[model samples]
Target: MQLLLLVDNNDRAFLSDINLYKNEQGKFIPRNQCIKLKDTQGREISLLSHIDNSDLYGAIFTKFTVVSSSRFINETVILRGTNKHGQDVFLGLLLDKYEFRSFLDKEDELCLFISDLDEICIFLNNNNYLGSGLINERSDKQLFIDLKNNMVKLKPKMNHKEKFCTSFRFFNKDNIMVNSIIIPVELSNIGATNTTTVTLK
Candidate 1:
């Protein structure tokens, strides 16, 4: 698998060599991987020298395990992963939906296009999936994707203390059903604080 990390609107870094191993559940997951930055001339470049105290850099380099992923019809994907520090980091990837499906045909050759790293972290941290960064803030609803079933669902902006429940079906690429997962989301807004809680049912 390939991981393309975009440094900015203009600069990018590519990690072409990645190792993936299946977990106990038989799902393929990326191993601990590091990125090597290079210029157009194939010369090594220092990523740290380009930016200081970058949350995007730390999130990408830190050891993390992907927990959940959601994709939109507009070819955008939101990934949630938990780092070694027990912090949930969010990443936004931009790629054609059809291209992503093609990647599913060849799981080992999947290429991930990650962009707007910093903004994704900030927006998702605040429980705002539809934010002004990589994800379209103009969107009226939040998106949820079932990768196994190739399905997508949307939820309207919730009022304070609103509760919502949804069922997600999981399947493998071969169209074999694995399991069904039910998620209950609660949105609580009190005094100046907004909190979103997700629980499995």
Candidate 2:
């Protein structure tokens, strides 16, 4: 069992459970169930549903943090987690810009919709992005958000070379392309004070 923390554009946070099951391949996978959380009124509101091809691939984390942000030109879903396999996973979704600015500017309440498979698609006021990853380990995980370039990077606190896997997607009104790769990242002094910490047992 793992926990997923969802932070909406309004900065309201919701926590939900992520159930895992063993697949025919003898690997653990997350069930594609609708993620719901209660609002201040105690009404159950659906945050994410119709999740297709939900696969964690045995990458279990104590906790997962997801943050959704909409800027002038782009909407992003940032996922951060360190799995039990001693690997850091960073997933980001970059979608068409200005799609949600009108609604956001008006302070209208918007529901979040996430779909697709390995490439997770997130929707806000009918906009979407592809992202996936697991978060775990230490409490001092640092993340750098480069709004100018529409990128989010994790800076680990460990000293050795760590296995860092990333999948980032850029989607526009005309073109859609996804790049997924696993690379090793060197750990060094993290100077970014803006961070999110996930402490695992």
Candidate 3:
């Protein structure tokens, strides 16, 4: 089956195993096959499998968007992946509020919520630009702090805070590079103005 490995920010192997089915009340409940591993923050990570290897990789390779919402936080993230059909894969899902910042690391290594090599490869292979609208609705101050910390760890050269939408773009036609975040703003009298840009390099 397709395995979803959970890793720390350093890309180290955290948990590895497959998903198995157990008979329960005349039905089947899927269970994990490996032990849990703690990341740098002492958060437990696990490996999960949904389908067979053939289909798992293919589904994840599709481009998608990730949306995280909670009683106090709400945000959206978009990402793209590579697939065998020549059509880029796009994935979108909602994640736990604190989970996004679980991989923040200023050191030599960055942690990952998913550690499966195959899945990671597929995700990195099919890359594209993503954007986000206003984020003033977030009521979780801690979540914002953690997210800001994670952004710092990402090594963004320039970051801007504005009441507008922002998006990321990648220009790695020849070599792999970081995607940049762009923002467009409108002044009170002016038509439209462009504010600061966050370059991920």
Clashes of each: 0, 5, 18
The predicted structure with the larger lDDT, 2 or 3, is 2
- The lDDT of model 2 is 0.32
Candidate 3 ranges with C-alpha deviation above 4 Å:
1-77, 104-201
Query: Lowest summed-lDDT stretch of 10 residues in model 2?
Result: 103-112
User: Would you list the C-alpha lDDT of every candidate in the order shown?
Assistant: 0.32, 0.32, 0.28
User: What range of 10 consecutive residues in model 3 has the weakest lDDT sum?
Assistant: 124-133
Question: Model 1, range 31-123, lDDT digits (tens) per residue?
Answer: 422222222242233223433222333233222112232312233344443322335444433333343335334434232333322312121
| TM-score of each predicted structure versus truth | 0.29, 0.27, 0.24
* Residues 48-129 of candidate 2: C-alpha lDDT, one tens digit per residue: 3422212322233342223322211333534444433457654444444442222223211111232321122123221242
Q: What's the ranking of the predictions by TM-score, best on top?
A: 1, 2, 3
In candidate 2 the C-alpha lDDT for residue 130 amounts to 39
Q: Residue 81 of model 3: what lDDT?
A: 42
Q: What does candidate 3's lDDT look like per residue over 1-201, in tens digits?
A: 122323323433321122323445533233432223234243333222221222213222222223322211323333344333344333222233333223221121221334433322212110111211122333223223323322311212233243334443322222233344443321122236533332222
